[model samples]
Target chain A: MRDRLRNVLAGVLEVRPEEICADMSAEDVAGWDSLRQLEVMLALELEYGVRIPADAMLELQSVPAIEEFLTEHGAG
Target chain B: MSRLPTAEEIAGRRRQGLELTRVERPEATALHVLATFNLDLLPPFLTEAFDRVGRSVRPRAGAFGQLTQEILDPASRLYAEPPDEVLIVPAAEDLLEPLFSRPPSQLGPDEAEALVEERLAELRGLVETVLERLPAASCYVVALGATEGPHPHVLDPLAPERRQVELDRFMRGVRELRSLGPRTVVIDWDWHMRSFGWDAVRDERLWYLGRMRLNPTGCAALAELVARHAAAYRGQARKVLALDLDGTVWGGIVGEAGLGGIEVGEDGVGLAFQDFQRELVKLQETGVLLVVCSKNNPADALEVFERHAGMVLRREHLAAERINWQDKATNLRDLAVELNLGLDSFVFLDDNPIERTWISQACPEVLVPELPDDAAERPAFLRAASWFERIEATAADRGRSASYREQRERRQFERTSTSFEDFLSSLEQEAIIDPVHEGSLSRAAQLCQRTNQFNLTTRRHTVAELESMSSDPDHDLFTLTVRDRFGDNGITGIAILRYAGELAEIETLLMSCRILGRKLEDAFLAFLARRAADRGASVLEGTFVRTAKNAQVETFYPDHGFERAEDGVYRLTLTQGAVESPASIMVTVPANA
Candidate 1:
């Protein structure tokens, strides 16, 4: 689950897996913006086959939030 | 088509044309977009959409307003655009103004009928205007219906009935507008609405803030749909739908579980396979050739299509069947050769992921769509990809699957023949070479643009350009019509020649690969040489520009009694000599007639 979260973030951020730390947020990532936030949510939904409902994907800023979100959706 | 690209992602493709200024990029496949709202976010979505079909799209945007300027406007940014494909995405709100602004209860039937006519007429006029202005560009109109009516006003007694009438009238208007086919195609947003409903397509918040109405998902869907139209317009439609028998067409292994055990009946999970077969038959009716590639006894598999009561696709429905224990890739190659179609034209479907993976690695050109283990999702999975989209379905397109069957039977007869020449003479083939007219223009342009293997010089001309070439005295553009004993390979070959001074050059020479082994090229070239001599040409020169796929025709000129004048150019001196065609081929020249 952690690796998948890292990969998704890395894929969106165009950074290495190691570069995506736990404390990472939109401010920390150079390329992540509001538009990318929607893209990241869309990607997560496609990859996990579970659409993040209402404002749930909005809180997915840090790595922990994404992990928690995917785990709740029964996706790794 | 999978996911929309972020604005930051590939900032190069997104940021390149942000100025609304069109710059020409000759290499990449291009599409022009004319929209009512702000399409700032649509370009990257287009990039992502085109990426699915292995094409990188360079989209040129028109001015913001719908009726602002036509593509023919020299001052417009879209004037420099490729006239092959243009997308018209007029918002439904703009098209049907009164309907959107009012409640159906307030408006009586007479008013609704009047409004429908008004909307339809305006749409027709707009379409006609675009068609006249951009004669060459095939426009795909995104028909966004105002499907979301005002919430049921219970206070009004006859509101429901009026709404129904209004909806029917709207549909009739759309259908009538769409009837203007070939040059125009209306991509119904209803297809996308199925996945995400009207709530998702309409954006009230964005509508209030800016004129931009569609939500992000709606924008993505529209972009995907446009990209599909672009691919189809460029002759990239997948022609073959390859199906697997066991666990695919039916829900069981036919060898072990016999005909009765197969789950393709009127009930349970069997109904899913039944429905799936019906969908395939529908696709065949719309002109996609169906083929079965499975690993089972030929007779055993044949029984399913032969005798199954609930089966929608019978034995005759298939273009060709490869039902043996042979590997799929080998069978696929055999099918490609048999049908004379490129591997890129195939969409392979099998339930097993292993076989799909193997075929993917072996022949990456064949699209292997993933199918769920559950049979219910099979039809939807196959139908989801707009791989078989055609700009227009002519009579020739409809006869394609039957032509393949005839080719198969012809191939079988060839295997038992005494000699190659004997086989050639056996099939009585006749070719009618005529000037490119309206009916033949589309197919001629298709062969010109899409034909890579048999083409010399690989010159592509649009329909409008071909029309001019056909009319010009200096140019002779003819479509080759082939009919052997088996079937008519309609408008199979396209020859474009330029006659200037005493020398004539074969500007373009292409034949449909279906007629490859029939010794038609000899007849084709002979006819061209005779035409050139008639136009008072001293020499006929043909060039072979080698591409990755056209290596088979490297010695084309030399094989046909032409000496190499320069490196790639071959010259043949014109004489009152007769280049005898094969005895089987009876060439009909109108000049002789």
Candidate 2:
């Protein structure tokens, strides 16, 4: 689940999956701006078959937060 | 379903485009964006989309709030660097104010309707003001969405009484803009939001943060729509839709499975292919020439069309057909030569992945869209493609399939006849030289843009520009219509003459290559000479600018008694009595002439 989440975020950020970690946030990645945040959110939604609610999008700034949310939604 | 690229994907593509140092950008359509919201990302997205599809656009960033002032001011960047396509995306919040913010429960029905009318009138004026200033450039006015209204307005989209009124006003503005000219292409992204998701279109986080109206998904769709509009206006829209048979148009191969085995009827799995065929027929009616380039026995392919009880398309439905075994690439090239159309104008659709790859490598100019693996998905995927986008479907455009079919019949006659001149003479060809009318001006402009190989100057003009030229007193505009015994080719020639007293200069004169090799060119020149003499002009001067496609016409003037002057202009002294019309074609002149 972490590998998949990291890979999806990496694809959205145009970086290698190894470069993305659970603690990696917008502050760490150069391309991880608010726009990339939305991109990663949508990419994760498409990848995991889960629609992250608009309110939940704010918490998805970092990879760890997304992984936790996906688990709560019963997504891999 | 079409995948809407993530905004990150769009950004990455834009960065990739910036790295393309040697890639040639064809038809650099200068674009200006005037939005009520922040469109900081739209420019790159638009450019990237344009680059993807045969065009390259350079947007003059995007202006906010003071759109009217920026457009009209000569010293402003809008006028200083005037664009070819102006993309206007007015927000509902900016166009309609407090009334829009209020719920329908608060206002009476009459008040709501009245407010809608008042706001629409104001918007009409704003659009008109922009049009009047930038008369040359085309406008893609993005219709305002009513989704941004108050809680009830956003939540209760199905509340027809409230949302419908706002929508009606927005659509009314779009309708008025449509009436202005062919140049104004309306992008109905607002309507697309019904399926594109309101959440995606109106991302509240970005809207509040920086006035960014669309999310990444919405931005991708908008970029595609804008790029298609630009391509359509530039006259780069694909003309031919070449279809491959045997698991393509039908389910089974006609050569192997036989007619009964093919799944293309009204029932069950066959319904999908039938529905797909119906869409192709619809596209054919809208000026797209349909041809067959299948690798099968010609007899077997014809048998499928003839004997198949489920087949919707008949023999006459196609402009040309090459159902031979000799590879698809050669067949397409032969079709191009036969139809007198450029290979770039073709969009080949074949079900076989191997055949698609072959043509993609061989004929890179032809647009072959990625088809779904399943037959059922092919039709839906085909219909959604932007390759056949058109600003307006005129009568001439609709009659194109019939015209191409007629050309095929003419070719048949030409073969059977003894000689080329004999074939033309026996056909009873009539060339009518008449003043250009309102009905034929759109076709005239289309001919000006599309006709290249036999064209003298190879100049492209929009419908608006052609209308302006036709109305100009100095320019004597005449369009020639040719009709043989086979069929009417329908306004195949255009001659625009610029007269300065006795010395009349040929501003524009081009004929459709479809009507070439018919001696109509000779007749067109004769008509021009007569018109020049009628106006007491001594000489009819013509300028033959060299273009890659028009090299065949470089010696056109010298061959037609036009002596080259020192200024590089072709000069032909007018002699009313001596100017002889071709005996082969029966030339009809105006009664006064």
Predicted model with the maximum DockQ? 2
Error of 1 at B270 (Å): 1.1
Clash numbers, per candidate: 0, 0
Computed on C-alphas against the true complex, the DockQ of each candidate is 0.07, 0.11
In model 2, the runs with Cα more than 4 Å from the true position are A1-76, B16-29, B72-76, B104-106, B148-161, B412-426, B434-441, B500-502, B534-536, B583-593
Q: Which ten residues in a row have the lowest lDDT in candidate 1 chain B?
A: B12-21
- Best of the candidates, TM-score: 2
- Cα lDDT of model 2 by residue, B77-116, tens digit: 7767768778888777676665556666776556766777
lDDT of 1 by residue, B394-510 (tens): 677788778877887888999999998888888888989888777787788778777878887887776656765776889998888998888887888999889889999999999
What DockQ class does candidate 1 belong to? incorrect
The TM-score between candidate 1 and the true structure equals: 0.78
TM-score of chain B of each: 0.84, 0.90
**What pairs collide in candidate 2?**
none
